[model samples]
Target: MWELFLTGVDAVMSVQIMILIVLGVAVGIVFGAVPGLTAVMAIALCLPLTYALGPAAGLSLLVALFVGATSGALISAILLKIPGTPSSVATTFDGGPMMEKGEGVKALGAGVVFSFLGTIASIIALMTIAPLLAKVALRFGPHEYFAIAVFSLTLIATLSTGSMVKGLFAGTLGFAFATVGIAPVDAIRRFTFDEPNLNSGFDMLVVLIGIFAISEVIKVAESVRSGKNAAIGSVSMKSIKGFGFSMKEFFGQIPNATRSALIGIGIGILPGIGAGTSNIVSYIVAKKRSKYPEKFGTGVLDGVVASETANNAGIGGAMIPLLTLGIPGDAVTAILLGGFMIHGIQPGPMLFISQGALVYTIFVALIVSAVLMLLLEFYGLRIFIKLLAVPKHILLPIILVLCVVGAFGLSSRVFDVWTILLFGLIGYGFVKGGIPPAPFIIGFILGPMAETNLRRGLMLSDGNFVGFLTNPISGAFLLLAVLSVAWHVVGSLRARKNASTELAQA
Candidate 1:
């Protein structure tokens, strides 16, 4: 083990490898900070470029990009109240408010520092516990997967944060969207309307651009028309020296950061659920556990810590399942699976045995990438703040153009562009209806997984529905899902009761 570790260290220590890692991190930050672009797109674009490099160098670049992109999302989330990636959605909750309060430097600093810590923590866990975690993940069958998906969907209760009915409606709408293409099991088309483009269904990228980027543009347009553009606020380009926080505050956030990182790692190890879910889940958990839960959405550092930490940690956690089990945890890692196969590297137990040094080298590269991401983002902080100075009227139109370009870039289909515009309008309607888009996005991402797995589980059990309960893992997850919904109901009832009592007294 020691010899292989040393060999791995030597491989990544080369000047060329170091340069690639830095370059990749820089490029990834740019992509992630820009609305409508994401780490998945960055990795996809760089895929062909990897063909010209050595396997170690190519993979290292991708790893660096992954680290940088995840961390880079905080830039837009804080400065513009727009999440650069879905994973940064929770970050926008508190981060945007912090920026409005002229604490942009502090928010960005905390996000960057915690992101580094979270990535490092997850990498350490991946290095030490990957094989064991992979073994555990192997036990998950179709029934278990379906149950997990159900439980994940129930998290919409936590994300709703406003109206449960609206949340459920939005989530159900997402599920309906997911079913537009061919049926998973029967391969029968459902809602194609004779359009060849609908055969493949709506691209996730198109949906994301439409919901986030295009809708944001529409909202900005409305604000401009109403002459309330001042609500968007301005960024304070405050000079921050170190991390822009007192040592006491840093110590205070340690527990939240640790818990969030662990959640990220656990979720990352699970297939299907990615940092996008982890960030929100972690933020919810942190808020529920905090002494001042009421301050969560009001620009608290705790919220930023939980969000940034978990999403970045998820990168390492995601790598664990990908490398050890050959299962991609999320979309970016799915692309990475192709990167591995392209280099003739098949990830699994045997791959580890066959290429111990190479695997270790990749691990080392991940750690290096985390450190590089921190340094790069820290130095580039001022530049990102400068971007906030761009007027909303000008900036939003640019973002709208980027959204169109990004949607069109997906498969180069005009149909996807139309999809973006359609979803943009739908998202705008959702906003007007006071429905949170987070639950909808989550439902859209997880709906197909749940449907496919449920069908597969039933088929495996020979149409015996009881088998889902008979399986211990599946039963446990299903029970948890039910309890989650029940808990939400109980909380809602208690709140309403309290409100009624207060009204009567008044």
Candidate 2:
């Protein structure tokens, strides 16, 4: 193992490979920091480019892109209150608040540093326990998957944090939207409305851009119309130094970072679920475990650390299933699977025996890419701060144009652009109604997974719904889902009662 590892290190240490890693990380950061553009899109665009390069160099480039893109999401989430990707949604909760408090540097630095640490932790786990983890993942059948989705959906309550009723409404609405396309099993069109465009349903990217980016543009426009300066807060480069926090502060986040990284890795190992879920789940876990949970969304480094660490750690966890079982963990890894096939390399148990050196080389590249991402983002911190100084009126228009371009770029269809516009209006309405967008996004993403698995589980059991309860794993997850929803409901009621009692006393 050591000899093969050294051979892998030697392969990636070449100047060409190193340069590609750096270049890929830079490009990925640009993609991830931009609204509507994502790491998946970045990898898809670059997929064909790798056809000419050697497998090691090409795969390494993709790895760097994945790492950089996952971490880069913090930039926009903190600075603009727009998440660059779905995975960074939770980052906005505290990161935006931190930026508002002039702690933008601290938020950005914590995000960057924790992201690197998370990736490193996951890589170590992948290298040491991939096969074992893959074996466990194989035990998950449709029943288990359906149960997992149910549990994940229940998290909508936790995500609401403001109004559980509004959160449930938004999540249910998202599930309804997800059902607009043809049924996964029956292939029957439900809500196409005789329009070809609706057949494919709404693209997740379009929804995300509409909810976060276009709505933000509308808000800024409203401010401009009212003759009030768009207040994004002030950022001074002079006030920021050395990642904007003391060493003691970094050490304090170690526990949160470790836990978040573990959550990321666990989520990544599960097929289909990705960093999008992990980051949110980790944030919730951190908030629940913190002694000062009330300070979570009010500009805390702990929130930033939890979100960034888990999402980036998910990159390594995602690789475990992809390499060991020939199964893609998420959309990004699905594209990576295509990259492997293009290179005539089939990834599975035999892959290690057939290409041990190449496997180790990829691992080495991932670790090196993590370090490079940290260094690059750290040095470029000042430049990112300057972005806050850009006039909102001018900066927002550029962002609006990019949003349009990104919408169109999804499938090169004008329909998607319209989708973005429509969702933007809906998102604006949601905001007015006090409905949280996080649960909606989560519901939309997980609805199909839940439905598909449920249907498949039923079919496998010959329509026996009892199997869901009979399987230990499935039963356990379902019970947890019930407990999670109940816990939130009780908490909400208690808080409401307390507020009413206080008001009456006053």
lDDT of 1 at 116: 95
TM-scores of the models, in the given order? 0.69, 0.65
10 residues in a row with least lDDT, candidate 1 = 228-237
Q: What lDDT tens digits, residue by residue, belong to model 2 across residues 1-506? A: 79988998999999989999998887777667765557865665565467679999999998888888888888888887888788899999999999988788788888888999999999999999875754565568889878876776676545444677887787778778999988899899989899988887887767766776677677657766455323444456575667778999999999999999999999887754679889999999999999999999999999999999999989989898678756555657755775786688977666777888889999999999999999887677555445434555776677677777767766678998888788788888887788876567667766787899999999999999999999999999899889877898898799989999999999
In order, what lDDT does every prediction score? 0.80, 0.80
Backbone clash pairs for candidate 2 read none
Q: Measured by TM-score, how close is model 2 to the native structure?
A: 0.65
What's the lDDT for candidate 1?
A: 0.80
131-191: candidate 1 lDDT, tens digit per residue: 5754576677789878866776665534455677777777788878999989899999989
Question: What's the alpha carbon RMSD for model 2?
Answer: 7.0
lDDT agreement of model 2 with the native: 0.80
Candidate 1 lDDT at 396 equals: 63
